[model samples]
Structures are given as C-alpha cells and as structure tokens.
Target: MELHDRRQAPWHDDSFEGEMVAVMTVGVPGGEVLLETSRLLLRPWRVDEAVVQRELWTERDPRVPPHRRIDEDGHPTVAELEDSIRTHKVWSTGLLAVERKASRDVIGYCGLVDSGRGATGEPELAFELLRRVWRQGYATEASLAVVGWARSSGYERLWATVWDWNTASRRVLAKVGFIETDRKEVDAVHGTTLFTTRPL
Candidate 1:
C-alpha cells in the first residue's frame, strides 16, 4: 500500500476499543461502516480525530511532497483537517481508520481508495501506520481485513501501488497476497511506483 494520499492518491495518507469482536456490516453506503480484526478496528474517522491526521502528515517521509506534508505554513492544520472530515464523503470504497484494539488507540489507516489508476470500481488498497507501530504486523492484519471486506463486497480484484523503495510496505503487500506486475509509474524524485494486484 502506498502510504501517502488520504483523499487524492494511492500514497499519502485513526482508533478503537473493547475485547474486540471482529464485526463487518456490509451494504453500507458512503463507506460509513465498521470492521474489526483480532488487534485492529477499521472504522470511519471521527471529526475530533483531525489531530491524528495532522500527526500523520508530520510523520510522512521527506520524500513525500511538500503539499502532503505539514508545509511551511502548516497548510493542513488540524482545523483544516477537521473541516475536511466534516465534509469528505467516503465512498463504499474508502480509507478507514485503523485502531489498535487493545489500547483503543488509533494507529493509522488501512483501506481501499479510488486512485483513478485502475478499472472502474476497482479501488486501490492503501495503508499507513504510525512510526511507532511499524513491525507488529498491523499493516498486514488491517490489509487482510480490507481485502476480505472487498472480496465479500463483490470486488473482482484490488490493486496496490508502492514506491519501489518502500520495501516494508512491499513486504506487507506480499504477505497479504498481492503480486507485483510490470506496471510502473516513475517518479524521478521519490522513486518508481510499482503496481501490484490480488484477484478476489
């Protein structure tokens, strides 16, 4: 999964509760639905959680574009994020908040996004986790849940694009059943974007 764009792209790019019963309610419109895994909860972002989003912006790698980062003027302020959360309409295919079930702390986001890079209705699989949660299998776990969600929702396939340099993310995608294809979009500054897909 590309770890960058939350609303406009595959890259660039939330929390939780309880004994963690994994629940998935299908047939929901606007992506306003909930899902859970043994250690993660995938759900919509609350308006008050803009701070977390802002923190994510700050944590982005320097390779990310300035606009996606905090920016010189702090363009994507928490207030701006709050307003975005108030207005953005997450589609049936959307990026959901990933929360750590045990601590109820939102670690990041993992879900499908319409990057306009695939066939109609075939959303891209995207995920980004806090630097603190990098190696505990959270991305793989959350991604598996999203893949299962997409398969159950009738999607025929799912795509994921990752920077060739992002080996960690590539590993996560491989673990979740995505296979790399020859497709590539070269970004001279960041690296080549490698495309991968998994058939449902």
Candidate 2:
C-alpha cells in the first residue's frame, strides 16, 4: 500500500469507541481477531516484516532516551526479530504489527502482554511506533482499537507503565482513558516508572 496523508484520509472514524470491530480474517492461532482503525491496521506480524522491525529498533529518533532506544549492541538483527515473532505467538494476547492502511508499511507494534509487576496475571498494554510517526495520533488511535478488542475478548482490565521522563507517551495513554495508578516501580533500564490502568 502506498503511504498517504492520514489526517486527510477518508477512512478515519470514531466507531471503535462503541464496539469491537475486525476485518473478518483469522489471526494468529489463539490470538484476537484482526483489527482496523480509521488509518491503521492491527494484525499479526509477518516474517517478511522482520526488516522493518529491525529498522524500528535501530533507527529511532535521536530524541529518544538511551534506555528506550536500541541497546549498546545496536539494532536487533533479523534473526532476533524472527525469534520475537515466535515468542509473540505464545503470548496470551497479541503484540500485533501496526501498519498504515494507506501504505501498508509496518510502523511498529501494539497489544497486550502478561505483566509481572502488580498482580502476576494482569494483562498490560504496550505499544511502540516508528520515530518518524511521532506526534501524530497513530499511537492513541491504535491503542483505542486494542482496548476495544481486549474488552470484547473478556479482559477486565489493562495495565501500562511509562518512564517518568517520557511525557509524550504518558499523554497518549491518558488520551486513551488510562488513569495513573498509585503504583510506581524502579527499573534498572528506565529508572522510575509510573503505572496506569483502564478498566474494560
């Protein structure tokens, strides 16, 4: 798909707020249905997209803090992305690829993961977008769609953590109706992190 200006695209809508909608296709075995938002597609990661995943890990915007960007060893090699795909397959929920509908370019990933932080089995929402797409509403838009899907799948609640200094991501979580919880944790990688949640 050719990339287009999402802001002016005609397919954008707010219907995700009311129901769980999907594109009528089978997703990864045991995963949730494929999801589509006004400007994006949320689906299982394809093996062919490993190169894109590597790019996201290696080419992040310079403004991203060291802890958030690629590790000292540099970008994840294609072999690593392939291994990650196998791991995502076993997740109770997806770590779906976020693709621009207009261009079909894989941007990043968003979905739920089992958290070990508070309650051991709580599901946590997670997302990361390509740096080039920063400041756009894609993160918020994709998250709302994921939340809708999670609710339909019978999840009662979702959790997330954002580094204190990553204010931009915090705002995206807030926009999607996530409220900060009274929990904070210290991480070796991210320092102090704030926890947030949204009830399904």
Candidate 3:
C-alpha cells in the first residue's frame, strides 16, 4: 500500500533480496476464499474491521509516508477506511486479512496487488503484520500460503517491493523464494525501494 508517486530510474542495487492460510468462507468480497494455514486464516477483510486497519496505521513506522499514516488531520479516518472497504473490489486478486486461528485476531494482510512495476495481469505479493505479531513466523507462514495460491492460480510470475532498510521483510521474502532484482526506485526521503521476483 506504500506506492510512491515520484518515479526514478531503475538501477541495480545489490543490497539484498529475499522473500498462507486456509479457510472456507463465502459471501465475502475476496472471491470465495478457501485459503488457510495451520494457525492462520487468510480471508476477505470485513467492513467492520476498519478499526483494525486504523490500528495498523497507528503502528506504522515514522518513515512511512504521512499520507499512509494517521496525520494531524486524521486523514484516512476510520469512516473513510470503512467506506473504502465497502467499495474496494479486493476480489481474488487483492490483499486479505491475516487472522490467527486460536484467538481469531487479525494481525494484518497478505496477498497480491496490481502494482505499477509489474506487467499486465502480473500481480505483486504484499504483506504486513501487526508489530506485536512480528518474529512469530506469521508473515512467513502467511506469505508461503499466498505463494502456493498464486502458483495454483496460474500466475507465472509474482513481484514484490520493499524498502532497502527493511531487513526483516527482506529475510521473509528470501525465505519465500523471491530474489532481489536490479530494478529499484529511490526516494530521497523514504529511502530506496527494492524489487524482487519469483517465478512459479
């Protein structure tokens, strides 16, 4: 969800490279999800769950853009987020909520998204977890499930973008079979964006 508006020349940065769930649920907007992991459930986000998304906004690192965070004006307020959830397609090709089975608490989201860096029909893998859930293997677990799902869905390739300094996410991506490519976008304020790819 941290796409940049500024475009820059792509270059080779040899910094690093790296990088699911199941449940049967219907009537959700995310295309009849049947994805689950041993301890997680990847399902469509609910309208009432905007508060969860809001919490994620609060937990974002300061380096994250002001627009993506809760600004002084409280932009992207819960009501706006709820409206977005009500209207956003999310279909089978959008991010789904990552919910822990034992507690039924949603950690965050993992799935594919239409990224500008990718070709038509080639979606990018995206994921984010609550700070409290970090290092619990939830991100890796949910990401693996998404990869399997992408492979089964006939996608021949998947892309991912991460900040250069985010070693944690870089490790997760490497663990999941994504290799860092030469393509990169540098933002002076936010840092460099690294692109990675995996072929199914």
Better of 2 and 3 by lDDT: 3
What pairs collide in candidate 2? Answer: 1-103, 2-103
Root-mean-square deviation per candidate = 7.2, 7.9, 8.9
Judged by whole-model lDDT over C-alpha atoms, candidate 3 comes out at 0.76
Model 1 is weakest, by summed lDDT over 10 consecutive residues, at 9-18
Every model's TM-score = 0.85, 0.77, 0.84
Would you list the rank order by lDDT, best first?
A: 1, 3, 2
Cα lDDT of model 1 by residue, 1-200, tens digit: 22122222111111122232345654455536577777888888887878888888999988875777888887889999888877775522377888887899888888888788977778899998889989998898888878766765667898999989899999999988999999999989978999999998
Q: Using TM-score as the measure, which candidate wins?
A: 1
Off by over 4 Å in 3: 1-30, 91-93
**Residue-wise lDDT of candidate 3 within 102-170, one digit each (tens)?**
999888999888777887666899998889889998898888877776665567899999999899999
lDDT of 3 at 98: 87
| Candidate rank order under TM-score | 1, 3, 2
Whole-model alpha-carbon lDDT for candidate 1: 0.76
Global fold similarity of model 2 (TM-score): 0.77
Model 1 TM-score is: 0.85
Candidate 2 residue-wise lDDT, 76-123, digit = tens: 678877777766562223677888989879889887766566454457
